[model samples]
Target: MTAWIILPVSLSTFSITGIWIVYAMAVMNHHVCPVENWVYNDSCSDDTAKHGYPKSCCTLNDVPLISKCGTYPPESCLFSLIGNLGAFMVVLICVLRYSQVLEQSHRSWVNTTALIAGCTNAAGLIIVGNFQVDYAKSLHYIGAGVAFPAGLLFVCLQCVLTYHIAATTLDLWMAHVRVTLSALALISLVFSGIFFIHDSFLLQHLAAVCEWIFVIDILIFYGTFAYEFGGISRDTIVTAIQHASSRACKSPGSSSTSTHLHCNPEGITMI
Candidate 1:
């Protein structure tokens, strides 16, 4: 069985589950108000008199955005840990994807661009996790600024590459799925950005919801990679490593056996 499929699965599952857990922790600790409460209240105000709770419970700063959800003590640590590990997995997956595309098709700059965008997104995620919005507002916004667009670009580029290299009906369908996902992600991002700038509490809440949709859409897109990755075998990774070694050897002219390091491309799958 191919083990590479585990990468995307683990990434999506861990990140999605981890973020929701952070949200729950924030709610339980009164760090943030529950998202459901936004439906009933159109304004961010003192909920103490209404809910018969303390004045510190569910204030304006406590809106349940993902960043806000993880802004507090214990959950913030988990958030940072998740971001670091998720970023590592994202880098590994993007590298494997680039190598796979290189082996399966004529090497193109699009694949390389996508790899860069993925890495940038991962870097932004790291910053977002480590720099809490409440504590480090500027750094957190900078990270978000980098992450959102880069992630959208990566998914869109992957959609194009998927169509370009498609060999079967399933590949075409997967490409279509990716396109739809990227489109929705773009729309959600735009709405989130526009609403986020508004001063109204309701608009800001909607913006937060849109942000959630955008993030979850990106995670789902990553999960789709598992379908293609299922075709990969141990030999695929070995060949990619050998090919890199061969290129390194050829560049420096240090070894005569560089020519013999050429791997059989036949082992690479179209998917």
Candidate 2:
């Protein structure tokens, strides 16, 4: 029932579901243009036809032939809204839970840095979602730049923390799994970046796919927190219940109190 368990589960379920919903809405709405229709030209309107590239999601200032997947009416708004909210919730939970995790561990400065990086990544995600690429290209790109790199940094930091804790307190297998996920995320992110930068249409498509992979990997990694938090929460509840029961049993003049402590140590009459 603690927020630690609730938040991680919420984040994992909402983010994965939300993004796919947005993608489905966009595609079903026919907002995406075919890859064969993409082109580069002086005018945004003319690029799709002249560039001789496959039809894809239209960028800002694209010609009439290109589909504006991210800018079309309710779908666009829905995508941004879901993305912004999801990012905010996930990051907030992570930040709050991170302190507890650190407290359980060695509480090193590196973990603190990871928390900061996670916050930065969250901020970047908010910015990216709010500022659609078509609406504000420069701002969108800036947000994306901040988000991707910071996200990678956060992942790396978490992986290191997991390894450190596993060596001492946590399960070694869990630590190994986290490290493996982080590595996969890192690799996917790198390829996504490269494909996004390349001029080829096919490369751009590959970049999009890689980006999805990167996101999925990160989400899965975050989902693992549910297991961690669940264990902690169970222990906390058990401890609290035991402590409360002990207090109740030790209370003066309680009918159910154990005979072992019936006599008061202070020799004072009970009210």
Q: Highest lDDT among the candidates is held by which one?
A: 1
Give all candidate RMSDs, comma-separated.
Answer: 4.9, 10.7
| Residues 1-271 of candidate 1: C-alpha lDDT, one tens digit per residue | 5888999999999999999999888777777778877643434455552332433444456567899988878899999998899889989888888778777874588998998999999999999999999899999999999989999999999999999989999999999999999999999999999999986778888888999999999999999999889887665666566666546656755555644564333433231
Q: Give the 10-residue window scoring lowest on summed lDDT in candidate 1.
A: 262-271
| Residue range 1-271, candidate 2, lDDT tens digits | 4556776677778877876766665555545543344443333444443223443435523322111345555666765776687678767655654654554663467777887888888888777777777778788788778877887888788777776766444467788888898999999989988877876656666667678788878877777777567545444434334433556656776775353565442332211
How far is 201's C-alpha from truth in model 2 (Å)?
1.4
C-alpha lDDT (0 to 100) for residue 145 of candidate 2 = 85
Q: Single out the weakest 10-residue window by summed lDDT for candidate 2.
A: 60-69
- After superposition, the stretches of candidate 2 with alpha carbons farther than 4 Å from their true spots are 1-3, 33-69, 167-170, 231-271
On a 0 to 1 TM-score scale, where does candidate 2 land against the true structure? 0.71
lDDT of each: 0.84, 0.65
Deviation from native of the Cα of residue 24 in model 2, angstroms: 1.2
- Each prediction's TM-score against the native? 0.84, 0.71
Best prediction by TM-score:
1
Cα lDDT of candidate 2 equals: 0.65
